[model samples]
Target: MTAIYRSAAGAAAVRDRYDTLLDRWPVPSGRRTVRTRLGATFAVVSGPVDAPPVVALQGSGGTAAHWLPDIATLAGRLRVYAVDAPGEPGRTAEARPPLTSPAYAEWLDDVLDALELPRAAFLGTSLGGWWALDHALRRPARVTALALVNPAGIGRRRIAPLLKFAGYRLFGAWGRRRSLAMVAKGSPADPGRRAVGEFTFATFEHFKPRLEAIPVVPVERLRTLAMPTQAHFGAHDVLLDQRDAAAKLREAVPHADVRLAEDAGHFLPGWAGSVVTFLEGERS
Candidate 1:
């Protein structure tokens, strides 16, 4: 396990560098606003209003900034709205409710109402993917399409390997950095890797506390989803077993199309072109 510098100065430096990079390569031109609801102000990042809408939900401890890499690639064809999940960091006002699947679905509906987007395609990664799936099940008519990138909440309950658990406990910060590094290496888009990694890492840092409060999804509820779903998992993902996650999703959404990215990891959307092609082809 690598040691993370615990000093205030070190943390500050890390934060400053992260902010600088975010400012330089901001998510393609969009509107930013806070929607006050349930004692929280959820931050909303919206692209062109005239285009077909696609809402992006970032993973646990991840922010809207993580989707910037795929923004331009997706925005050309659709209006992209990246939402900062409440209770997590990065622009959203924090008033965290108990992190349950149903609660998340309700909150997402509120966000859509605030944005005035009656129906839109939903794209998500990891924990965000879990919420998106649950949201689709709860409001099938509101979601036109579903795209999940290495989504969580699909596997059975079991403790992670001892060594991996120990590493996460002892070197949580360093482990996050290493994971971001791996994401950068696995990403197919070269120019966006470093920028996206920095953004994702910073988001992880900011949302660490809130993330711990959320529980994994229950396996029994997986069968409820009925959307035209497209899920992608990295063959070599370190967090959740790719094969297990994919299998569970297949069992849940029997008709959904599932694909595997041979060399990718949890950060599947960094391989934007493939994802875009899959969405376009599947929709067509």
Candidate 2:
């Protein structure tokens, strides 16, 4: 846990806060700590046991609990296994395998093997989307479908907004909030969005995010993706070039559905409905 947190005490506080969130999970669920090569991989399993399985991966600073906003809708149609990705602020191992290495694919394979799932669809956001895309490219047979939101690896990261964000961090709390506003698209008055923002703010207070650069997927490799695929990008995204992401995806995977939300940023709060629809469409 110290690998992801600043200190032992910080890890404990983050875990406690995360556990409290599980009790409030929108649907009936059970926690599963699958022993993987990386370490004990924690996942929250919800929805009908007989339903089609979907592996859900959170972003860089998120936990399985971060699925709180989307779980109910997704779980209603598909069995959702929301994982606390290793090295993130969750009850998973602190071992952050190198993003450039094949380790993440192997770790995900171990997760599916331990879960006894022969194959499953994937729902990944941000860095999680990178994991899903990488695995799909590496082991396409094991992945049934793919749904990515503001995924990394397909677009180049924009420099200007990032530099501005770094400059904003110099202002302290107010600066941090300003930084967050530039990332997630939501009104401060909306209770649901505000709640998620509050949780994210609190989590980062104790968690340390990854500093390593995310690798971009090669165009030739992306062209090999054969599964049903969809990607969402935010026009106002400060981190990655969303227009380039959408354009590249369209060029590489002609059949893939790519959307650019003009009002959204890096964090898309109300994206569950469209994602669920896309996932369900593949089944039908």
Candidate 3:
């Protein structure tokens, strides 16, 4: 099951929280642009030009801001381009059409083309991870490396009922607080909880469209991807059973490196030092 955030009031609260967080930990220095194509607008945040390039994609209903925590750690090592998914909210604003997996691949390709990046490492979480892997398969030459954190869509495992539970239809101030508490349960670190809450609430406000638009890539297709890939999944992921998902991923992308975080959940990237180490190791 997918949760879509779409109440006007709820959106505002989320926006406020995101803005506040950005204010506190501003991007060191970079360029921000609004790229438009196919009637969709994408907000692109680019860091140092000479650094190794990486494009970060967030999960379903999430925006580019979902990467802020990692961005702080990765920007210096790579020219990170975090894109506000066209269909989700944040800087991107457009009436998105119903998108299939292929359409999503094309959209990401367009974003890369617009940025004039010949090749880049792709990092994604949950739905974003699925998209990253799909993109790699669609244009193997364009991807240098791929990293997925507690990603979704690798198998048929069901998400835990608690993680799927949202107290309100749309998260307002109270909903945000409650949602944060739920997210905190999966995250081991305090900073991780704060970052997850901010990102989740923002997603709740801006993204619109049916959850089904995010396609589940079958195991057969995954086996064909040739990019250098590393996937991390929490042992206790509430959204998807890691053991089954990891096994399927291994069968499909036999060459891909997979890591299991024993104490984490679906929100593994927010775990600070651990994720930083993972990214650093993969980059090396």
Top candidate on TM-score is: 2
RMSD (CA, Å), candidate 3 to true, equals 3.9
**Model 1: per-residue lDDT, tens digit, 223-260?**
76666788898876766677787887787778888887
Backbone clash pairs for candidate 1 read: none
Give the Å shift of residue 219 in candidate 2.
1.1
> Ten-residue segment with the worst summed lDDT in candidate 1?
1-10
Total backbone collisions, model 2: 0
Lowest summed-lDDT stretch of 10 residues in model 2?
Answer: 185-194
lDDT of 3 by residue, 1-284 (tens): 23234566766766676566556444565446645454444554545677767788887667666776666677655677877676565555543545453666777777878878777788888877877887887888888788888777775546454344544435577676665555445575657446755566546545554445345678878888787778888887666777788888888888888877777776674443444454455542
State the displacement of the C-alpha of residue 243, model 2, in Å, after optimal TM-score superposition: 0.9
Candidate No. with top lDDT:
2
Better of 1 and 3 by TM-score: 3
| C-alpha lDDT of all candidate models, in order | 0.65, 0.84, 0.66
Q: 11 in model 2: Cα distance from truth in Å?
A: 1.4
lDDT by residue (tens digit), candidate 2, 152-185: 8899977787677557756768877876777765
What lDDT does model 3 reach? Answer: 0.66
**Candidate 2 vs. true structure, TM-score:** 0.93
